[model samples]
Target chain A: MNQVIETILQHRSIRKFEDRPLSDEQIRTIVECAQAASTSSFIQAYSIIGVKNKETKRKLAELAGNQSYVEHNGHFFVFCADLHRHEIVGEMENVDLSSALESTEKFMVALIDTALAAQNAVIAAESMGLGVCYIGGLRNNLPEVCELLKVPKRVIPLFGIAVGYPAQNPDKKPRLPFHHVYHEETYQQDRSELENQLKQYNETISSYYKNRTNGERQDTWTRQMANMLSKQVRMYMKEFVESKGFNLK
Target chain B: MNQVIETILQHRSIRKFEDRPLSDEQIRTIVECAQAASTSSFIQAYSIIGVKNKETKRKLAELAGNQSYVEHNGHFFVFCADLHRHEIVGEMENVDLSSALESTEKFMVALIDTALAAQNAVIAAESMGLGVCYIGGLRNNLPEVCELLKVPKRVIPLFGIAVGYPAQNPDKKPRLPFHHVYHEETYQQDRSELENQLKQYNETISSYYKNRTNGERQDTWTRQMANMLSKQVRMYMKEFVESKGFNLK
Candidate 1:
């Protein structure tokens, strides 16, 4: 296997991190690498706010479902899906930016662009001997996150990422068999074969969680998914995004 | 900078690829790395279909706005926002999968999961001396792509990625200023400062494009955006997503 492939295959979400802070140079390099990722037609509709302030991190940690790792992580960044930049450009050009910011097309572009850039940052951080974890819980309080971050009308909080040196080596979580996800040229939903694959995957996941949690409830992947889906944790997202000027219409 | 960071920072989309095919082992490794990326609550709501058949590749190229790179790239992978697996699990469990597959939250999860995994694959491939380019034009014919690929309900085509050794050195595309995207704790629409930053960026982009295209009409960043937005490209995406059973309610 290629060395990069080897490194990526061994990836595990590092929640526990050493207390050491990332150097400014390191931060710059990671951000630059992130900026280098391809954007839709070079719009680059995303931004990362590096959070080093202890008080602010605590506040953000509270906002993100009280994730302690976020408060104490060596480096924290919040990736925003921003259309505000283009809105300003539109103003200077004496054009209406309202349609540009509100369109669903623009929202998709911003979200995808943000994800691509953040992913690059994650890889770059890992390559530089750093540990990282994405905090999707940041969306737990979307409006509050925006208010606290002082985000403008056309920019919304997408997700937060925490980066640092590893303090512990967590076990790699099991995934569904490749066949379960990979299809041919088109989408195929052959459940029986996938179910057969899932039987093994469920066992793998069950054992993984069991061993990791020291014999906690041996939950299969499906059961865990069911538990998650039953909750309406992100129900406000649509309205929130709309309020933030993303017209999904 | 770390070698991985260097690779990422120096990254460029390679439209032209060498004729050499990727080895099966290399493919396996890249896919494994992709799977290692974070999935929302580990639902892993995405899949990739590797295309090796020339006929299928040619058809896909035609479907994706006649991009020749799709047919000639060393490896082509179509990433799907997949909820089909969950639909099957629901059928077997006699549970409602409609809610899981149709919600906006679920769609966002699948999209983010697919993108994160694909980005990982890109990084890993690059580390192994491969080049990559994302094909957002794949969405140009969503239903056709779904029909041709035999995509099941609840699985939407998110994007395509082409990976292989580079046959040509493409120029690094310039990005908007960091401040244009990144904001502090809150969203700010302070236009004056942002516009100033954008002027510098516009100049940078104008010069870069001019040098690359050998004096081809040097369109400013804002002009390019206005031109793209003025045209209709993704106008049908909402309806297409709805047709795929993503009510996004």
Candidate 2:
């Protein structure tokens, strides 16, 4: 197998990191890889802010539910879903952007572009022998983060990436059996196969949580999904996107 | 730099293809690489439908702005942002899922997870010397696309990926300069710098479009942005997502 394929298959999320700082060159290389990722229609609807100041990181840590990793990582970057740059390009080119900025498809494009670019950054960091953790908790409080980061209109902080040397190796978590998400020709909602696979996965995941080298927890994949996904998490995002100059209408 | 990073830096959107089909082993390996990508909280919130049926691909081609590449590619996959499987788990576990499924955070998680997984698939394809193009036009007619793919509620087809052996090599489209997207410590709003940089990149891209071996055209990057993004693109997406049982609320 190729090195690129190998790097992709052996993926892990690193939360606990060694206390060190990433050199300027390393950060530059990572950001370059992020820029090289594909963009929809070449709009490049994304921006990343590197956060190194201790005070800012500390405040960001608080906003992200006080995850110490946010404050202690070697380097942290806020990946933003951005359309402001495109709007400015439109203004300079004298194009009327009213209808475009108001559509949900445009908003989805920005979100998808940001995610695709950030994933590339993740692979790049991993290939460099660095550990990375995606901080989705950055969305816990959106406005506060935007204010702290000075993110302008038509931009939303989707997630943060904390990069550092690995202080610990987390066991590779198991995924659902392949057939669960893969289908031939069309979507086959074989609930029975899914239910059966998930039931076994619940047991496997529970055992992993219980026996892992870190904080042992008692929960199955099923219990976690039911507990985490059924609740109103970030109920304000609908209005938040609208308020950030993104028309959800 | 490593071969993996080098591969990432050379990404190009492939629309033309040689008339051939992928081996079963190549398709299996691509799916495995996609599954191996990182997910938020291990929530692999995505499903992929492989479309080899000529009739289905033709219908998709019409729905996606009549891009013949959709039908002509060696392989095409509909990458879906899905939480339907998670809800099934919740039902089996007797967990109240309304709160989770009804939140905007949940929706964003699915979107991000799906994009991350798809990017891995793209890299995997490119590593195998196969060319791929992302069909964002999948969003052009979401309802019809959904009906064609037998997609259910809480499962949205985000984009389609067309993959094949390269029939033509297009120039790598340029991205905004690294400094334009990367900021130190905070978000920078430097319109003058951005405008200046884009003006130069615009010339570079215009020449690319005009002199490319196939379908030579005249359009600067800024002009294209103004022309393409200025109009109402995929205006039905807001209602479509909601109708599909996604809570943008």
Instruction: Name the best candidate (by DockQ).
Output: 2
Q: Compute DockQ for each candidate against the true complex.
A: 0.61, 0.78
lDDT agreement of model 1 with the native? 0.81
Model 1 per-residue lDDT at B63: 88
How big is the positional error of residue B5 in model 2, measured in Å on the Cα after superposition? 0.5
lDDT of 1 by residue, B1-249 (tens): 557777788889989998988888778778888899987788888889888889888988998889888989888999888887787667656677676577767777777788889888888888889999899888888888887788877888788898988999977787777666555445556767777888888899889988988989687888777666656667788778888877477
* DockQ score for candidate 2: 0.78
Tens digits of per-residue lDDT for model 1 on A1-249? 655666677788999889999998888777888898878777788878888889889999998888889998888999888887777777777776566567766777788888889898888888888999999989889888877777878787788899999999988887788767666555555656778887778888888888888998688887777666666667777777888888466
**TM-score of every prediction relative to native:** 0.95, 0.96
Residue B91, candidate 2: Cα error in Å is 1.4
True contacts kept of each: 0.55, 0.85
Runs with alpha carbons beyond 4 Å of true place in candidate 1? B184-188
